[model samples]
Target: MPYAVDFDTVSTAGLESSPVAPALAGLRANEARYFRNKYAHVFAVEPAGDAPEAVDWVHHILDAERGIVISSPALEATTFQVENIRMAYVFYRSGLSINVMYTVDDGGKRAVGFKLSDGMDVPDELASFKFARQRSKLAGTIRGSYFVIKNEY
Candidate 1:
């Protein structure tokens, strides 16, 4: 089942297995708020089991672009398109959230973003990247970093 993320009332409905469930829930809500505010799109996510395509897409990108592989299991995943941009998100049990933003137009911006929940340590595969902290009312302090996508997906 797809659960619509509510920024107004952050919940851990689909992320209970995570050690940093609260912070992860808040981080999920922050993404919901962004899409709602910017694109008038409701951000909904389903169990990773139910969204293999989205999960696989993210995995392929990680492997192809940076030779990176995440050790944590994904809890939920989502994929959607707004305007010309296609976006995918995977929420992992380690309190890590990864997003891929791909614009359909040639030479448009494309990147993979990594956001760590407030209470969790940065994953080993991502330690080399420096994360900048951002304060969010819903997610508390979020540490984030990203790399530009070099190849066409």
Candidate 2:
């Protein structure tokens, strides 16, 4: 079953297994609010076991583009299409969240983003990447980074 993230209230009903569940939930909620405000799209997440395709999609890109594989166990994932962008998110047990945003149209934006929840350490794979800080009432201080996608998937 998928849990529809409530941007307004910010809940982590299905993400309790993560070590930093509170921060992860808030991070999820921050994303929900982004889509809701920018594109009027609702963000919904499912257990990682239940969303194999979504997880695979993100993993495929990580391996192909960066030769990177996440070390943490994935707790939940979600994928949605809005306008020309296909967005996928994976939340990990280490409180790290990754997202892939691929634009369908040519010459549009394409990138993979990594975000760390409050109180979590940066994973080894992303240790070199510089993260920008963003303050969110729902998520607290979010440290994030991104790399442009050079290949079409």
Candidate 3:
């Protein structure tokens, strides 16, 4: 068989003011359009019976993605399905806990969009979130955490 290849590359370092910013913005717009068109219904949040519209997707992404970035370099690309998202676990530092739920849609058909935490209260002033995930079902045992958010900063 024969094939042709086309590739485009650019730096995404400067962010909003950079030359590549528009492209990134365009991509994000396209993603939003696609999400609205196809999966809008699958994603949403509300007052939950007047508890106050509590989920902050932005914060969730900041926290989770930031954690992923500063974390050990070898721990990217791993996946897991965290549970009990309805509740949270706040540490002694007062940062709330969260479950970054991951699902294998269509039985490996493709990975689904990463959803942010519905409930959490981390302090502002941090450009992005960075943290540790020490999971111990029983006391004194620390599980491992690994992942990264490339687009978020």
**What TM-score, over all chains together, does every model reach?**
0.99, 0.97, 0.24
Error of 1 at 52 (Å): 0.4
Tens digits of per-residue lDDT for model 3 on 22-105? Answer: 333223233234334554411221111221112233235545555322121110111212231222111111112222333334
Off by over 4 Å in 1: none
For model 1, which pairs clash?
A: none
Give the distance in Å from residue 109's predicted Cα in candidate 2 to where it truly belongs. 0.9
RMSD of 1: 0.5
Per-residue alpha-carbon lDDT of model 2 for 1-153, expressed as tens digits?
887799788777877888889999999999999999999998989999999999999999999999999999999999999999999999998999999999999998999999999999989898889999999999999999999999999
- What is the lDDT of every predicted structure here? 0.97, 0.93, 0.26
Candidate 2 TM-score, true structure as reference: 0.97
Give candidate 3 regions above 4 Å deviation.
1-15, 41-101, 104-153
Give the best candidate by lDDT: 1
Q: What ranges in model 2 sit over 4 Å off?
A: none
